[model samples]
Target: MKIVVAGATGSLGTQVVEAVRAAGHEPVSISRETGVDLISGVGLTEALRGASAIIDASATSSTSTKASIEFFTTVTRNLLAAERAAGVPHHVAISIIGAAKVNANYYAGKAAQEEILRAEPDGWSLLRTTQFHEFARQLVGHGKLGPFQGVPQMRSQPVAATEVAAELVAIASGDPRGIEPELAGPQEEKMSDLVRRYLAATGQRRPVIELSIPGAWGRGMRDGSLLPKAGTRRGRQTFDEWLATQSR
Candidate 1:
């Protein structure tokens, strides 16, 4: 089977591409880097041609609700339209866990994307998963003001990106399952502890402070809206296990 991967250059997208190849499937990639503009729907149909499935690992870095929403909503609609024109049967997409329950920042866009997919649910398979293990490293990228860096106080069951990618590939190859069982890491960990552990693993010296994010979304984050629920698919890699794999 030939798989078309949208946002093929991203963190998760790149892993998905690797997963597809490992599965012995040919991959057609679509991204700005691949000369396909997802926002404007330019070059999508052509790229999607002869593809059995297109996995939308499309993402945006914007924290603004407006920008995030615009990017996800527009890109999702475009992908679905292109899939229809190209005669692709399955569209697999990833969304944040509890995105529908917490419409804040990036999750806002994901929630909107879910609504669009729901319109024709039979054609798409939606898998909601917790944040990736790399998310802890993402927090470390924030430069400290003095001796300590502030991270949002939250709990996460962070799965490995590779595992998520493998699941997406499997989902794309099968018939759309509507909403699949959510995926999560084996253990729940604190944001601050993860960041501190990340710093220690990489030989960086920085104290981490757990700061309370303001507003309803912040409340949601701190309140465990993003935690894995019962019967969710659990990934085997723990945060410590993934950390050990990183280069020193």
Candidate 2:
């Protein structure tokens, strides 16, 4: 089977591409590096040519609700249109768990993406997963305030990206199951603690300040809205286990 991985150069998209290749399929990468502009639809038709399926792992880092919504909406519409034109039967999208329940800007965009995919004329499959274990590292990188790092006081089940990628590939290899089971880590964890541990592992001596953001989004984070529900599939790697490997 020939699989086209949208945003193939991204964090999760790279893993999906490798997973598809490991599954003995031809993995076609679509990204800016590959000359594919998902939002503008430039080079999309050419990139998707001869593709059997499309796994949309493309995403934006914008936290603005409007920007995020526009990004997902445009990209999804372009991909679906291209899929229809190319006669691609399977369209798999990677989404976030509890995106609908959360009030964050990014979640709003993800929720919009889900709505769009659900109504897709060509049909689609959606996989909702929790934050990746790398979330801690990302926070450290992005949440810096001078010499101190601010970590959100939130609960999370951080799954391994590789595990999520394997599941996505397995889904794409088979038939489309609209909204597959959610994937999460083995146990619940505190986002602040994860950040502290990450800093320690990297030998960074910055003070870690735990922040309790006040809002529905903050409440959802501190609460368990982002956690996986019952009957959801769990990954094997815990944050501690994943952290151990990261220290190498």
Task: State every prediction's TM-score relative to the real structure.
Answer: 0.95, 0.95
TM-score of model 1 relative to the true fold? 0.95
In model 1, which range of ten residues has the least summed lDDT?
Answer: 137-146
Model 2 TM-score, 2 decimals:
0.95
Best by lDDT: 1
Clash number by candidate, in order: 0, 0
- Residues 1-248, candidate 2, lDDT per residue (tens digit)? 99999989987999898999889999999998899999999999988888888999888888778898899999998999998898888999988888888946788889898999888654678999999998898788789989899988889989999999999889888887798888988888989889988888878889999988777767878888999988788999988888888852
Over the stretch 1-248, how does candidate 1's per-residue lDDT look in tens digits?
Answer: 99999989987999999999999999988889999999988788889989999999988878678999999999998888889999999999999998889998878999999989988848899999999998888777763758888888898889999999999999998999898889999998898899899999999888788888888667878999999998888999999999999997
Global lDDT of model 2: 0.88
Can you tell me which runs of candidate 2 are displaced by over 4 Å? none
Clashing pairs in 2: none
RMSD of 2: 1.4
Output the lDDT of residue 195, model 1: 89
User: Each candidate: what lDDT?
Assistant: 0.90, 0.88
